[model samples]
Target: MDDSALLQFSRQILLPEFGIAGQTRLSDGCVVIVGLGGLGSAAAMYLAAAGVGKLILLDDDVVDLSNLQRQIAHDVNHIGILKVFSARDRLLALNPSCEVVAQPVRFVAHQADAWLAEADLVLDCCDNFATRFALNQVCCSAQIPLVSGAALGWSGQVCVFLYQSGQACYRCLFADHPESAATCSEHGIMSPLVGVIGSLQALEALKVLAQVGDTLHSRLLLFDGLHQTWRTVQVSADPACPVCSAADSP
Candidate 1:
């Protein structure tokens, strides 16, 4: 790391657990973030500012006026443009040295391998179930850690799936999709709620990258914005889980 880069991240480097070594690891890490809305905005920006070497941004949606309420990585000038590109602009602005690969397309199964190639970690910030399930399956198969987060209607949740032996993958927690999964638009989301969850996702990602301190591995963190309370539940691997179980079995 150069003098300028070191000074730029001196605050993080000052942390006992996240010293220069951890900062170096972050500078050599690559993370794939699938979404550019509320959650993705915070995670991407924080990761970039923390000096993650590279970020693969995946999102096909265009920035809309409504997003200005919570998506901090975008602005009025970015309206009508692809979300990935908008986010990439902001990320680069935060850390020009950070390589931001903006893929203006939705995550698809056929292209999963290509999209996830060389990824040290992945952040599931997308709102829908299909993408979450797909990300969980791919991460499990590849043994890549996944930082999963969700926020809607004043409630948010975060979890880290290490995808290691005997560890739980996302499918273990949600065996089946919710019969009526709500979106931020439909159910109304608390703007700051996503920022809180997304920031936590970025924190977990940095811990996983630097191999420093304990992370949310195999644990579910629940945040109640309305009541301003928090709770954590241990998540166990589902023996009959279709995704992780199949991947683990011979």
Candidate 2:
């Protein structure tokens, strides 16, 4: 690492476990953000600020006037613009050295393999359940870690799926809730609620990337902003889960 780079992340390098090596790992990692909404905005900003080398920002929606209320990365000037571009600009302003790739395509299966194939970590910040399940399948197939977060109406949840040998995956936790999933647009979300959950998602992603500290693998974290309380529940893998169970079908 050059003096300039060292000077940039000196605080992170000062840690006992995260010396120059951990900083190097972060600088060499690539992560994909699957949405540019409230959760994605906060998560992407923190990820870039923490020195992830490359960020793949995937979102097909355009910034709307209403997004300014909660999507901190997008401003009034960005209204009608593609979200990925606006988020990329904000992230670059935080750390110019990080590479940001903006993809303005709807997240779909046909394009999933190419985009997620080389990612070290993937963050599922999308609002709907279908997108979450699709991203889970992709990450499970690629054996990449996924940091998932969601918030709607003063409530939020964050969890990590390691795709490790014996850990439970995302599909295992919510196999039956796909039909009842709610969107921030329809249900109304508290602006800062997403920031809180998304920030935790970013922190989990950083830990997974740097290989430092324990992650929320196989455990679901719930944040109730209305009541100002938190809860954690352990999750177990389903032997019949179509995604993770496929690994043993051979």
Q: Please give each candidate's TM-score.
A: 0.98, 0.96
* Candidate maximizing lDDT: 1
For model 1, name the residue pairs that clash.
Answer: none
Model 1: C-alpha RMSD to truth?
Answer: 0.8
Candidate 2 collision pairs: none
Candidate 2 per-residue lDDT, tens place, 1-250, comes to 8898898889888998889888899999999999999999999999998889999999999999988888999998899999999999999999999999999987896788889876999999998888888888888888889999989999999999998776888888888755677677788988898899989999999999999998999899999999999999999899999899896457
TM-score for candidate 1: 0.98
Model 1 per-residue lDDT tens digits across residues 134-178: 999888988889999999989999999988878889999999887
Candidate 1 ranges with C-alpha deviation above 4 Å: none
Worst 10 residues of 2 by lDDT: 176-185
Query: Candidate 2 — which residues are off by over 4 angstroms?
Result: none
**lDDT score, candidate 2:** 0.90
